[model samples]
Target: MTRTGSGHPRHSRPGDGQDSRRRRPPPKGRSPRRRRRPPVARTATANGLPSGPRGHWFLVAAGLLVVAAALTLDGYATGVVGETRPGPPAGFASAESAEVRRGGPVVNVTGDRPTSVRLPGRTVALTFNDGPDPEWTPQVLDVLARHGAKATFFVVGSKVARHPDLARRIVAEGHELGNHTYSHADLTAVPGWRLRLESSLTQRALAGATGLHTTLARPPHSPAPPAVTDLQWAAMKELAAEGHLVVLTDLDAEDWSRPGTAEIVASSLPAGGEGAVVTMRDSGGDRRQTVEALDLVLERLKGEDYRAVTVTEAIGMPSAHRRAGAVDRFFGAALNLAQRASETFTGVLRWALFIAGALTLGRFGFFIVLAGVHAHRTRGGTRRRNAVGGWPSPPPVTVIVPAYNEAAGIQATLRSLVATSYRGELEILVVDDGSTDGTANLAAAPGFPGVRVIRRPNGGKPAALNTGIAQASHELLIMVDGDTVFERATIGRLVRRFADPAIGAVSGNTKVGNRRGAIGRWQHIEYVIGFNLDRRAFELLDCMATVPGAVGAFRRSALVALGGVSGDTLAEDTDLTMALCRAGWRVVYEENAVAWTEAPASLGELWRQRYRWCYGTLQAMWKHRRAVVERNPFGRRCLGYLTLFHVLLPLLAPVVDLMAIYAIAVDDPLPVVAAWAGFVLVQGLIGWYALLLDGERASALWILPLQQFVYRQLMYLVVIQSLATALLGVRLRWHGIRREGTFNEFTQAAGRSLPAGGPRRP
Candidate 1:
């Protein structure tokens, strides 16, 4: 501490530690002031999120599982009604059972196990061994009376032989009695026939004394003396396979040492799971002490929420009719509960599916509406009427085309551009992104003039665009795909939208260049219905997510303000569009400005493109998540819409779809259908709306269902690869391989389609 003049300690300045003793001089060409770094931001806020109707797929999944479990339980109940259920106490040696079926075929095949099948409730088995002695049995009975606990006694038949009164009391007290054998000898050491004789004698004795037959048997411990062995397990299994479960101890109590009641209770497990078994050791114990401890253990475990039952009832293997009516009631209640669960799941799942389907279909509707608007606006002198309404004129345009291996379509795209009747001005900048083919020379060698070519190492499309933009001599930058060709008035339509000062970007229409094959045709319909309608609705909201890289124009100033085109992400166009809009820039769509691209000719090719697109979209969203919540200067806008469309839907839909598939595979499809039907219906509405909005003739409506059945469903498979790569952080780069020969291949797969032009049949 340093002292002030008043002798009071004061805090030192930040630089006061060690270097305070030295006098340092500033270096040459440096300012005298200490420089400060900008403050680091802790958290970014998302803003400009638009409201949207979206799906909650996770809830749908949990609901389905619940329903499935319920159905399984229900079906089991129905199966139990008339089927012959096995008795827990039946044995081959029992006199009455000697002529009856002692065990089923399965019991003989796989030895019975006393560990009963588990059910998902707090259920427990109460077993008492070496019992039926008069003194202990009566005392145990009184304690059970006090607390309402019932237990199954694995009786030493010899004890019952002496005290038939105690045996009768056990049965009268609503307890189950199973044979521990007459002599209490280890069945493991005895032959099967001898063991059978012992089991028979015990049963005969119990039946004579108590007038009840037992179904369950527990061996001495987790293992038995080699003779009695799993004969008990075998019996339990025999019972369980025939609709019964052999009760086994999941716990141990070691209470036979004459320990205090507190000690016995201390060893007890809290009642849950498949229930716990607390036992009296066979070797040593003051019978009275063991008996007394049983009372407290029962009380405490009951307090811990255990529902005690005799072995038969606990395992659903009751014989001698112990608590049969009550067991039936409990089983009935359980079935009812399962039915209710099934119904509830069906309700929730149906709604969730509806939402998903509806949202998707809605997007399609929006596309159609916008396309219709475009067609109507461009037709019947409407363009001339809106022409002079103070909308900015189409400025001189610079078109930057980045080519990697485009020897095929360079001439076609160039010819289309030269053929344009843009009233004002135009410029084409074809930056070759390090082409291995003759794409650049093809543009230069011919009468193709003014397509500025800047050759750069393989940096990607965004960097090439940036390079071209830097050398451009115009205020409007239109980046057309190297493989796409536009119509004569495409530029005019796109440029005219710039007249609205609020519009920062304008997206054009895109159609499949080739739609001959089944896959391509399906994609064609999907594009028309899903994309066109959606773009218009999005534009109206100023929440347009992606100004597709294929055909879009940007205000040069706005592009510059955003620090030029970025190559940091795969979906650079989407990233830039959202970034600009969130920053208060208005983005619109020009439906008349149509361009075409070669849709994948095969399912494999389509899958690859879609996979990459899905993955790229995710990367861009994550990279710019700051915009998810941060209120841009524009106000709260597309943020919510973007999350719903770009983040949440893709994140959740596949899970629901896949789980539904699994449910159908194992159980009934009713629940699965219930969960997803709402989604499908909503999808249909969207399809219809899209076609309606696009001004598409109802004649083309047939494609709507075809798209839904074929194209829309592809999202499941595509999302799988996207999700895997995102999770595993795999980088994917797809440089489409150019076919070996044919200029027809150029128009078909490499170049853009002219508006309403005959499709190139790839």
Candidate 2:
């Protein structure tokens, strides 16, 4: 081996041997080299651990829990059914005496002895149930006010909370208010604790809405006292123990069944003008009939010289409403505020779902149309080139592999490069960035005679690549990662693109080599469906964003003019490609030039790798944000697409997911499920088409549905964390993936059969 003036080893050729007897001193300005420290063995736990504090995940979980609780409360409050269903007629208990069973509708059991009372002759009490409706309650109140009649409204607490103004208007208009339970749940069907809870929440709602609590309670679906069942009596007794005066009805108009207005009005008139309490509804359904019946009933009663009064007035009892305490008012107000906030949040999520769906579908269509056009153009170009006998004479090329502790795969990488079918003079440069695993020794072994190994301190991949570019003897260079393997024609296919002087870089198609596991299959699907398909589309638009490092060819002049591979961004490939595009050089994609790279096998490793990729891409996009306003294709096409589809759409995806859950909770799930199914079907079609274009089997797509449940969420979370990190101005270190040397076996086998100088050019 010979040394240049800079003390760096020159490119070694076949049969170049060092003199065993010569002992050379250290270079002029530098001391003898210190032994490199063995690289630390990173454990699986280390790979899985997050680089930042885990507190963010805790906060996210807590926030999700709070939202879930709020949605649950809202759903429970508004989704109750059967609130006005008629009770069974034959379930009355026989324990009650004839006097108690046949007495008045207002029953007081709060004292040692139970008491029942009826209205006096010619005095009627009108009571409305399931009320405070925004629509019909006001109409009912208007009719009563017109006739100077005072009635009672048994208000559902949820309805009152939602329409507090209506509750207040009832009191202002000289009517009485009574509790109908928080969610209009049936007292006989609920447990003792739930009954208590129902009463408590209703009181709080009343306090929040009207600043008062009612002692008059009406169990939902309660019938006249004569028909009270054993279970109903037990629940009424519990309410009495809680100091409530149970109010039952004397006459049920049954307007909830939408019976004719004539029947409703006839039912409201007491038998022979006897005093009675009549039940009607202002809510739970269309109540126009009830409103009209009330007007007619009032006119008829007035014709007979009968007067209408409130329940408490007709029963000779004091007011049922009292001012609420301060604590109840505060908590009730908080509940109202929380419910409103949850409703607002749900609305936002619905809008987000619509926007995300539009963007996603639009992107899918864009990829399909443009990618098809690109494929047609590429095939036509290939046909024309074949007619012209391809490149008359290929140019000399240098292949640079930057390695760091890559002894596990360096030999395989070198062997794969040596076996290339490229006709031109080919040089392989392995720049070992201070690896303690004998990476340089593996590259310079006896099996690979002409491969050159350059040793340098561990200054990172960008520095190592810069050193390789500086030392290369050819004007065309191809960069490859130490863990990637190439097809025999990969270099030839890549170099052929340089026939056009305007082409600055060519990105080869990258495939996953070890895609047997679930994680690997998911990545394989992404590479084909996401990265490569988008690349095809981008190439046609002339604004390709990234030329992957695993296999990419570049004109050395173009690279040198831009100051080779800057370390300013972790995604150096994307940064460089963007710069080239902005500099007016065309960066294209070559689908036929394929390279196989190993993908992460474990979820932890995959998370780390993708987190770095996403965060770095964000950094690069920010660093080159000025391009958006520039008059170049990179700005007009590339940046716009990346921002809309990649950043904005992904950020909105979680809302779409939340909306699905909300629909199932408070709305119909069939529509949401149908939409999801349609989305999946469209995605499957796209994946199938992509596999056909890439010459892969469609069997791998069976995992696509499962990906939605786990892989998709993981990616969304990555985007969120990346955005957070970017917003916080946090600096992230480069994450290194541990390689398993997946291609070693095949490359070793090929190496044994090939000649010492590698295979002959085809």
Candidate 3:
């Protein structure tokens, strides 16, 4: 063997060997020499993410924990079902018995405790319970003022805290306030100590609102004097010990029942000139009837010579107690803060759920419409076809295969490329990007002819591709990943797409070559469904986002015009394609141009790969965000599509997932499951159609549903991690994947059928 002018080995006769060796070397300054860089030693984590991704994981966990805590607090406060903690009392605890003693308005309960409510004859004390409502409370106050009457309002502490202004207004307008217990929970249903806290909390709320405290209290759920039960008597004794006057209604208006105004007047008038207390609500529901009844009852009471007065005033007691201490003020402030926080968080969650539902439905509708159009166009061939694979004399092409430490798969990839059936002048540039492995040596080995190996420093993938682009000897360039294997007609089919001069780049259909495991099959389904279908739609819209690196065809001038592969993003292919589109060039998808590439076989590998891809895509998007406002077609269509589908949709996807969980646990799980299943079904149908169009089996879609459970979550997490890291301004280094050369293993492990030429490795 003798070395030719191009440094390739050539066969020579024994007599011609000396002459071949003596052939003139390349002219001075014209010879291409391999570029070398010193190897730098670096440490790597277990997951292959440079600088470690653990910090980003921590940030994401912290964020999720915050959201979870907020939701948990909101649930706890609302007496929501399914929560582990005990909820508020179902209703006011059973009523108790109390009697007026020694001709005094004070009531002596059966529990050997003194509770007082002075019931003066004829001068009926008309009191309303459950008040401080924003809307109805104001109307009740106005009626009281119009009649020149004042009544005590038994205000629920929670409502007073929520509407402190109304509570203040009630006092400013001369109507007195009474405690109805914080949250309106039944004291009898809770322990004695809890009952004390409930009363104290209400006193604190009153103090915070009106700068005054009231000892007058009304036990919830007791309509009249005789209705108070034993348990309620015990609770009443407890409140009495705390200096609270338990005011029980004598005449029950039952206005909370929304009974007619006439009945309310009749009930309040009372039969035999006995002073009484009436019960009504100002909040917690529509209170139109309560307000109306109060107006008519007040009018009838005036005609009967009965004047409504505050409970304390009618009972002949102090209207309000002395100013509260520091502890009471602190409790009031804290309760108000918690209530405000709970309300805010609840409102946010409600809106989040609504937005999530809308986005889920919108995504469904958008994809269905776009996919339907894509399928119809595919069936009808509305776009002009660029005939591929039958040219008598195809144009010359150069295939650039960028390799790092891809020694394990490079040989088979090279073999697959050499076997392409295109009858064109084809050259292969194997740019080994500073690999420690024997990739460059193997590519330049005598077994591989016309394969030139160019060595460069480990400047990353984009740099390596640029190196290859600079050294290529042909006008048409096809980029192939070192781990990818192409079909015999793939190159021919790809180059044919460029028959239209406006076509700057063409993306090929890249299928997972190593579909031996569950993970691989899931990716295979995704490639078939998520990616290919979108590409078909994008191609028709002339808004193609990416020309995948696995197997893509490009014109040399177009690539150079965009400054070759961009290093600003890890997704250089996407960046370059978008740049080309923005530069007034067309990017198209060619489904017939098929390449089989090894996908990540493990969850960890898949996460790292997808994280880099998503993060880099985000970087590219931000770098070109200005395109959104541009007037060009690429700006209007491509930028708009990417902004909606890529950026906006991914950001909104997590909300859908969260809503699904919340709905399943807190709302209705079956409908969420049904909706998810419906989405999967539609996606599966789209996948089936895509496979049929690509001449692949639709059976691959069988794993799609399973993907939602495992693979889809992993992808969502990847997107989340990337977004978290990017938002935090954390710079991530390129992480190399630990490839097992699954291409060879897949062929043997599954006993799968090979392409026409059979397995190239073994």
Q: What lDDT does each candidate get?
A: 0.58, 0.79, 0.70
Q: Give per-residue lDDT, candidate 2, residue 368.
A: 95
Best by TM-score: 2
Error of 3 at 340 (Å): 3.2
Candidate 3: list runs displaced more than 4 Å: 1-62, 72-118, 186-208, 234-243, 326-331, 379-392, 445-450, 636-710, 745-762
Model 1: per-residue lDDT, tens digit, 171-282? Answer: 7778777666555554444455655655655555555555444555553332211212234444433333433223345445666665666666666554434454444532
Alpha-carbon TM-score of each model against the true structure: 0.55, 0.85, 0.82
Worst 10 residues of 2 by lDDT: 1-10
Q: What would the C-alpha RMSD of candidate 3 be, to one decimal place?
A: 9.2
By TM-score: ranked, best first = 2, 3, 1
Top of the candidates by lDDT: 2
Q: lDDT tens digits, residues 1-762, model 3?
A: 000000011111122121222456677889756567544323224353545445767766676666565565455334342322223333334323434322233354435544455477767676778777888899988988999998888888877777889988888888888888876666667777777877887787777766678877777775454444556666778778877767777667777776777777677676666677776777867788777888887887788888788776776667755677777777777766676676797687678656755765675566556766766764554245434533346889999998888877787777777767777889999988777878888788775667889987666677778888999989899999888877788898898767778888888888876776899888777777668767777777777878888888899998887778877765677778788888888888777788887777788777777877787777777777777787656767766665665555566565566656766887558998998898788777767776776667777777778887788677777777677667766655556566666565533342332274223223
Candidate 1, after superposition: displacement of residue 749 in Å? 17
Which regions of candidate 2 deviate over 4 angstroms?
Answer: 1-52, 80-90, 94-101, 387-392, 447-450, 499-502, 636-679, 751-762
lDDT computed for candidate 1: 0.58
- Candidate 1 at 148: error in angstroms? 9.6
